[model samples]
Target: MAHETSETTAASSVDAAASSGRRFLRNKVPEVTVSFWIIKVLCTTVGKTAADLLGEKAGHGLTGVSVLMSVLLAVVLVVQFRTTAYRAGVYWSAVALISVVGTLISDSLTDGMGVPLETSATVFAIMLAAVYVVWYRRERTLSIHSIDTTGRESFYWLAVLLTISLSSATGDLVSERMDFGYWLSAVLFALLIAAIALAHFALDLDAVWSFWIAYVLTRPLGASFGDYLSQPTDDGGLGLGTVVTSVLFLGVVLGLVVYPAVTRKDVTQLHQAARQAA
Candidate 1:
């Protein structure tokens, strides 16, 4: 009876480990797709204009708006993390809030505390690199496909936030400090993203790195694009105003998200490619 009991206990332990491992491998995020990129860029554009509108137009100082928006962001993120499966509404809401907070962080350092754009960009770049190093060291993979575990998801969100800050800083450095017109800056980043896509498709770039490179560049691209429409002609823009730009882009984002939500097209499946074997 004692021997039989010992065998059963060992088997149960094995079963439990297997179950945990399986759960850890199941992705809880959306799959990379065309819709993903479209929504990502649109949300990033909103990040730029919405932050400005809330801070300047909405009758709140940057600090006050940041605090209010941060509270709302916390609630949205809590819902996102508590979900067991990928949810388009929850996921995109989190992304949008991250975009807003990221803009606030970058702007606060530069406009609020007198940090130079170059300095902020360089600092954010280093911070992003550090996150990547620590993440890769612990998980041995930096691919977004394996963000099923709590630790990986945390790392993913941290990376996303850092990337947005870095991108915002860099965008301002090129488009404002350097005095490149908003339209020109938009063209510049669009070309850069095109190059990355070419490298991925034509030259056989690593899929994970390609995805991330494009992702980082889109931040600046969207910022420039947003500013081009929202800023006045005196500043080399289309003079649409923030209200129009925000409403237009957000409507598009809503449409794109609805399609994916109803179709379940972007939901990550139970078994997908992983970097572990590489």
Candidate 2:
């Protein structure tokens, strides 16, 4: 009876370990929530203004700023990947840095390399589509909720970078090439996001597609909004300046991130439980 009991306990321990391993895999990313969207938009706004502040205002120029931000982004992502579970600070830091890097990439193509914004947007869209195809083929899903392994997380970040680049290029194309202006461009992207939400809630749009589409739109919306606040009034903005605008949005982001970090509100319940168990 004692030997049988020991065998059963060992078997149970193995099963528990396996369960914990699976849970750990899935906890690397946060759950989607309203706070997620709010922070994402705010981060994009800060991305736009901060990049401008460094590249244009602070005299680093686009090339120097891009190199600096890209290096910083890579470091943050390394920390992000090393973590075992969802951490608001690390994850959002990666997002914010990627946003700046993505914007700089689009800007470099347009202003530095003399590529048209329309062409950049089209090329980025193709790249994004290719990433999606490869990701889905390899992982069998494009849903963020399934970012359970390093491979998935790698794909997720790549898709995110592409989306930000595509959105920046598309926003510039619409606002500059089409002459929509900052305010109108912001409104246009905002409405498109609202439409996506409506379709998801009312018309049964696939949640994954809706989330990805809205995610792409949010960057441009935030960028336009940031430009409207940061540019001079003569240029149709409020004259807040990029420094002020970036600081303001980043402050709000800090405040919002603190709440989730303290409460772990953004971490899924299963993730929290698994983390505690581990």
Candidate 3:
């Protein structure tokens, strides 16, 4: 009897160790909450202004900036993928970089290929929808809770890229071509996002769908704000310059990310702990 009990104890210990290892492999994406949305918008604003700063103000030109941002994004994403756990810096840096790359792609389609902004926007929207459909079919859930696997993360980032690209094209098309102006465009998108939030919280809308809808809208919301601040006064902006706007938004992003890092307020496990205690 004693010999049999010892063997069972050993088997149980191994199982416990395996379970602990799996816990570390939980989904990496942060929770869908107000902080997440705020930082996302800030990152997108930086995406727009920083792209302009690199390509035009810094005189690297579109190709140079595109290559530079793409390389940086590749490096950041590699680091993010290697970790079994989420690191705030690596994750958010990847996002900011992917944002830059998305902006470059939209600009290339419009300026380099002479594709109309409205057409590019429509094309990107279709691509984003396709990603969502395939991702849902494969995963059976579009919830961020399902992002633990590498495959889900890939789909998530692809969708993010498409949203960023489409938002840029659509924002510029409305603000410049449609003459809505930067301020009005920002307000419009912001209101739409607000409605999504209201519907989700008050009207019992699906959490996942509401989160994604707001997520996509933030790209244009931020882009419009970036354009409003960075463009020349004659171009319907405040004439703050790309450099200033980029620096300002990037600083805010850095600060917000650092807070989450230090407090672990946005980290899934820690967030749950904090909530439980409250």
lDDT of 1 by residue, 1-278 (tens): 00111334434534564666743344667877788888999999998999988978767777788888889888988898888667889999999888999999899899888999999999999999999999999998787766777898899999999999999999999999999978899899999988988887789787778887888999999999999999999999999999899999999999999998898778643322221211
Candidate 2 segments exceeding 4 Å error: 1-23, 269-278
TM-score of each: 0.88, 0.90, 0.87
Better of 1 and 3 by TM-score: 1
lDDT of 1: 0.83
Model 3, 1-278: lDDT tens digits are 00111334434534554566644245577755567778999999999998877877657778777987899898888888887766888889988998999999999889878999989999999999999999999988777644667899899889989989988898888888999999999999999988987886679777778778887889989999999999999989999999999999999999998887787666554324323433
Better of 2 and 3 by TM-score: 2
Error of 2 at 108 (Å): 0.3
Please identify model 1 stretches exceeding 4 Å from their true place.
Answer: 1-21, 269-278
Give candidate 3 regions above 4 Å deviation.
1-24, 58-60, 269-278
lDDT for model 3 comes to 0.81
Candidate 2 Cα deviation (angstroms), residue 234: 1.0
Positional deviation of residue 255's Cα in model 1 after best superposition, in angstroms:
0.4
Residue 86, candidate 1: alpha-carbon lDDT: 76
